[model samples]
Target: MKMKGLFLAGLLWMAATGMQARGMEHFIDELASQQEVTRVSLGTAAMALGSMFTDTYGVKHIDVLCLEHCSDEVRTKFGQAIADLHDPDFEPLVSHSENGERTKIFVKIKDEMIREMVICHVDDEVAVVRLKGKIKPSDIEQVIQDHGSDR
Candidate 1:
């Protein structure tokens, strides 16, 4: 028997465009692709390890890391990025899956024009891809509000 996959192509979204630059240099290697990051940096170590599932992913703390490889600037920038995350922007990208599971990701490009980011996967692995893009708690809240869901 043969099987197909779920694929999403050419998705572009717009954000509020009212955020401050939070230069964060997180994300080391791509467990997946370039536009899609396979790792993130939360607050605690557990959160980092817990960042393997793409789906059901979220961080209760202000700090997090998806991997063990982090530079001091990246670490400091991560904290500062979170602290500086004022408002986040959303630019839809390509999403797809082949294992019968759907792969969803949202890339944060010019958040405050100082940070950049890529979305790896969601609802599959313990992963929350953040590519050093400027983002605020409210921005995340906005997504939850829009999606009618929360963490």
Candidate 2:
């Protein structure tokens, strides 16, 4: 009888943990299921190749959802969803708007390293990109400096 109680507690704990982990991912997946959106996912190997020319050195996974030619309703929904997003693990890093386009970036950090990043961009089209990796703040600063020098 004691073993049965322990098993049920274990299962409940796992379920709660999984739900927390899937908080943001669940919304992204639902959005990607829309007929008008295009979803692209890259695993570790693909990310290594795809980011060869960029500053994604430590990135292990990437998921991108692009919604082009979508209706205004869909665009508004996407924006609202991002605005309403609240996750304990992810903290807002940067948010800005330029030329009628808005961009919001959120990051999840663990052990002094960024474990996940979510970038939500809304313009004429909507784009949501999620990057998972073990990245240092200095690494991101270097990328910014490198790009800033181009101007």
Candidate 3:
């Protein structure tokens, strides 16, 4: 009985770990299923094309969700969802507001590499983007610099 209990506990731990690993992706998918949201998922091939112009070489997958002209209830729900993501695992890397629009960037890091990045933008239109891969902070900094120079 002791051995069986230990085995079951191990299985449960593994299951929980796996779920946490994909938590961001699952959240994005859930939002995508809503009638007011539009989702776009980009795979490796698309990311490869994107890397040509930006510093996306380390990004393996990207999920984008856009909610436009949504009801106030929907907006409140989305805002709460984003707020719930501000846990120890996901650190807020950047947050700013401009022209009535607010944007927040969060990153989850493991072993000194960023494993996932989530960008949430709230305004007249809500947009959320998730990027998953092993990325260095410098890679993100370079992307920001490159884009900033273009403006």
- Candidate 2 TM-score, C-alpha based: 0.77
Weakest 10 consecutive residues, lDDT, candidate 2?
A: 48-57
Query: How many clashing residue pairs are found in candidate 1?
Result: 29
Q: How well does candidate 3 score on lDDT at residue 125?
A: 72
**Strongest candidate by lDDT:** 2
Q: How accurate is candidate 3 locally (lDDT)?
A: 0.82
lDDT of each: 0.38, 0.87, 0.82
Q: Write the per-residue lDDT of candidate 3 for residues 1-151, one digit (tens) a residue.
A: 9999999999999988886766665667778888878778999899888888876748889888888856778877877677566455788988888897788898999998999899998887789988899999887787778677885
Query: What's the C-alpha lDDT at position 92 in model 2?
Result: 95
Ranking by TM-score: 2, 3, 1
TM-score of 3: 0.72
- Estimate TM-scores for all models: 0.26, 0.77, 0.72
Ranking by lDDT: 2, 3, 1
Clashes of 3: 0
* Candidate 3 pairs with clashing backbones: none
RMSD of each: 18.2, 4.3, 4.2
Q: What digit string (tens of lDDT, one per residue) describes model 2 on residues 1-151?
A: 9999999999999998987877687778879888888889999998788777775758899898988867789988988888777777889999998998888999999999999999999878889999899989898898888777885
In model 2, which runs have C-alpha deviations exceeding 4 angstroms? 1-22, 49-55, 149-151
